[model samples]
Target: MAIIECSKMDKAINSLLSRQNYLVTQANDLARSFGNLTAFEHKVLDYCFSFVKAEDTSKQIYVVQMLDIIRHLGLNKSGKNYQRVAEAFQALNTKTALYLRTYKNGKNGIIMTSLFDYIEIIEDGKIEFQFSQKVAPYVFELKQNFYSFKLSELSNVRSKYALTLLKLWNANSMGKLNKATIKGTLEEWESWFLGSDNEGKPKRWSAGRFKQRVLSVSIDELGKLYPKNLFELTVEKSGRKVVGYRLDIIQPKLHCQIRHT
Candidate 1:
């Protein structure tokens, strides 16, 4: 692993992020969870996460004006944009589902739940919601130790693939780790990016198609985002067939600090 000092631009970004009000935090489990959200929906989800205070609980009903999300994304306030923000929340309600394995009383089972307990979009533009009880502990623990990034840093990431990659990178870095490597099988990579199908299976794509569409596009955008950093993707092969991927991100030693509010 190679270490580079933070560049001028990197320092500026860190400074700006330090002043921003929205820092999205997630436990590695939630970061690696399966979700099929659009780019705008992802932004909305992050915006909601930003409002979570250290003292907040899953049962706490948080409220935010829908326009606040639009403004935070640096979008012009328009009827169309408002509706877009509203619809994104609606999509998040169904699309951000999580299925986790659980064990209790010597029995093993699966827990199926969405990120939000419920989302109420009032006609007056106020949006109220709460995290599911099952997912609350993870969110709450993130304040102590978790991967976090500012929405300000990710506001320009237009591709869903790129956004997901950014989040995964932050998660895998484990806080101040300057160089992080993410290893996953082809199926796991697909589930992380393209998400599951109607039958609850990862969408199958030829290796060529998956690389061309998801990996290359995402890596290209991420390279632009962190020009001073290195984003390398190596394909793992079994004979002539692709089996998995190893992605390594090397950057400067600037500690990604998460502020507690």
Candidate 2:
């Protein structure tokens, strides 16, 4: 057997150690953002967490019941007004409803304050929302690394990519996914713009024809390909007319080998 190399092993070990340190730092930052909580705040957060996690029936019934109990409980007995408790309930309802609406609306559903409330409730009594300073850095990092990708760049690609990304983001955030279910949505879009004979039976348009029309209207329009680029087109038959063609990207791969002595 050949002698082992210490230098390579040492470099690999150092790289792994650095990665571990980074993860620890990230976790500590998140924990700090949660911060210490007051006893009353702890109870409220616990109720919120339980309210969200319970079964559908439990959540539906207990959410209102718990709020009423908290409002009238001895903790707030000193103040008969129960203004804060009322405010918390209203805020919770509004935030939850708004989150549902946003989820329904797709990418447009993101709201900063609602997101804060969500984080607050999920953390329970362990972390206070006041110490959110530590969380902002991580949020900013996430935005930079992931959310910052331009939607406009995506819009130019086939709608399929845009629709797929929207579905993925929704599934990751809300545990539910909604995709455009209307069959031939993309095909219909293509026919509206590039179909050769509007009245005649819809003919399956080639990718080259689609690209040509796109370039003719505006060279800057999205999904335009070079004249020389190789593309494959498939047309589907419809009862009355040809539906439309699908365009795909293809690139040639080259392989090379080297012999070392």
Candidate 3:
């Protein structure tokens, strides 16, 4: 017979964590800076934020079970899985997104913030981490611009571009968005997903090239993600040459559901 011992740190982490279903994250005018995360890295970051200790100002260690991560990522429990998870953190660790907050004077905006602090792999296939206090409010606090969806639902999204599209769509309030959706020029679409610099210049992706490379491919891949009716990806055309795109809300399964008894 064997007895399992739980350290005080483990106990503290367990006590701190809440079994929340949805992985909530936000991107307001102050926190919209992005460095372009891959599919795996993006989802893993969201999973960690799901357990962020909103009440703790000081660094709080939250334990995440490897099994849950593996299951969420659709990977079998194995050494390779462990390696992949570690790699995801390694990638996210170095990947920094700036948080820009305006001040009273608003003297030519330039205040940068780090999103993640550190990560540690622990015993029993569990991991620990701490996020910046500046990020806690936007993540856990309520905001008109908040974006949240199920942690499990995003596991199947493999296309980085499509997932990015979803994030940008949710970042905005879902009204003027319809106009943005309807008038989806490729230049605007690229800026939203890839983002722009302080001077307001985005990485180049011409409409024709983007259509041939990312646009059509991302739409198809997104269709394959869970909650089948994720979004109605419409490619607006002008006599065979792809002109623009329109992403219609199809009541994604993660966001909208009807209960049947």
Candidate 4:
């Protein structure tokens, strides 16, 4: 077996992630921005994202039936399921906050906003919603650029960390690329997984705890989703201090490449 040097791997991973910035754009930003959403809320958000079209603008209102969402989750049409779906939407309306970075007038700034302008769930029938104008651009970009799977493909995913990692993978991977790598500072890794606190700050975790709770758990589930793919995690450290992480994924050539229209 060949031994790989940590410094060399870190350089290569950083280079790849850096080059991807132009292509990934707002989609990757959105992937790393939000924090408080639950697994079910993430699914509901993906379901909403599927409605975005290449030609649609931020002002477009999307109407989807609650029954369709239930069916998409592979559940029978029952009162309990309907209530659960409705509650999920309510959580989505409240929890889908986005924090984005901006540069203007030679100064750096941040944009704090919610993902949706408003959401209305009718009596077990249909839901009407609109993505916030501030976030709609990212949603549109996510659909056209980073959304690799339909809502159906994610129906069985039960972990928010796994789902978030899948979005991150799609954000970083260019179309049909055989291998993809995700590199982030340890703090970023925690933000992508645990999100932020009620104070709108990323939650803190030790490197060991983060790897065990976030990285390992996500990889285990994704392994089930893509049995043929290989995922390798490398820890970045400075002397005795942990700094960041890199996840290298080697995917089959003909893996799931479905994109939502």
Question: Which pairs of residues collide in model 4?
Answer: 35-195
Ranking by lDDT: 4, 1, 3, 2
In model 3, the worst 10-residue window by lDDT is 16-25
* RMSD list, candidates in order: 14.4, 23.4, 15.6, 10.7
Q: Write the per-residue lDDT of candidate 2 for residues 122-143, one digit (tens) a residue.
A: 2121222321232334333333
Look at candidate 3 and give me any clashing residue pairs.
none
Tens-digit lDDT track for model 1 on 172-192? Answer: 887643577888998778777
Q: Give each model's whole-structure lDDT.
A: 0.74, 0.31, 0.56, 0.75
As a whole number from 0 to 100, the lDDT of residue 177 in candidate 2 is 20
User: How well does candidate 2 score on lDDT at residue 164?
Assistant: 30
| Model with the higher TM-score, candidate 3 or 4 | 4
User: How high is the lDDT of residue 35 in model 1?
Assistant: 47
* Candidate closest to the true structure, highest TM-score: 1
Runs off by more than 4 Å, candidate 1: 1-26, 142-144, 252-261
Native-referenced Cα lDDT, model 3: 0.56
Reference-based TM-score of each model: 0.82, 0.20, 0.62, 0.81
lDDT of 3 at 230: 42
Error of 3 at 219 (Å): 2.9
Q: For candidate 2, what is the TM-score?
A: 0.20
